[model samples]
Target: MSARQRNAAFQAFSWLPHDLRNDNAAVFAVRIKDLGAGVQTCLQLIETSELEREHIRFDGPPAEGDAADVPLLSVTDTSILLRLAITIAGVISEQAEQFCQASEDRLVKARSAATSTGVDHE
Candidate 1:
């Protein structure tokens, strides 16, 4: 994913409820660069509804691993958390869009001033 996407994810994750956020702060505080990786590995089961219903199918007994290492949250609870994370991400994306537009406006004004001042290209 793009830096913007990861940043949005991190921002969203940070906006969760205090108790839950604190409980999972390590995962919630994941670095911007690690959002995509973390999501794929740690939260893959929480994929979009379409993907979950269409692509995910279980046919055999579950494999055993380090269950103790995993969080004990139920699917409903996990969905709520993921929803909050995505909402925050959307906010971040909107803010970035605004910032980019403002930056472009400033650049345009700066270029106009430079041209009007008889600045020459090298």
Candidate 2:
């Protein structure tokens, strides 16, 4: 599906009844570190991989200005980070789908019960 449809599917809980919404608590995975560690983190991501001397491509960093001043990751290293993001987003989408489906089912059952009991379910 398109990204918009995926996003809307992820937010499908908004369409559920209030009672069904109350049954869910969203879960997220988070990483936390002490302050001022962000710069170090970025540096580590790039420096973690070293280009070999025999490499035919990339020719060892750039011949341009300020190689020492730049924080750059090779394509392979950057791909790892991008894949992590995609994996997390996929998890979130799966969670949303399960939650919304369960919620809709619960609401339907609740309404059905109410009607069978001669109660007005508006």
Identify the candidate with maximal lDDT: 1
Model 1: residues >4 Å from true position, as ranges? 1-71, 120-122
Shift in Å, residue 44, candidate 2:
15
Encode model 1's per-residue lDDT on 1-122: one tens digit a residue: 35687567454545445445444334334433354454454355555443544333432333576233233455676687677667656655665566568679977888888899998543
| Per-residue error (Å), model 2, residue 37 | 17
lDDT of 2 at 1: 35
Clashes of each: 0, 0
Instruction: Write down the TM-score of every candidate.
Output: 0.42, 0.47
All models, RMSD in angstroms: 13.5, 13.9
Q: Candidate 1: deviation at residue 18, Å?
A: 28
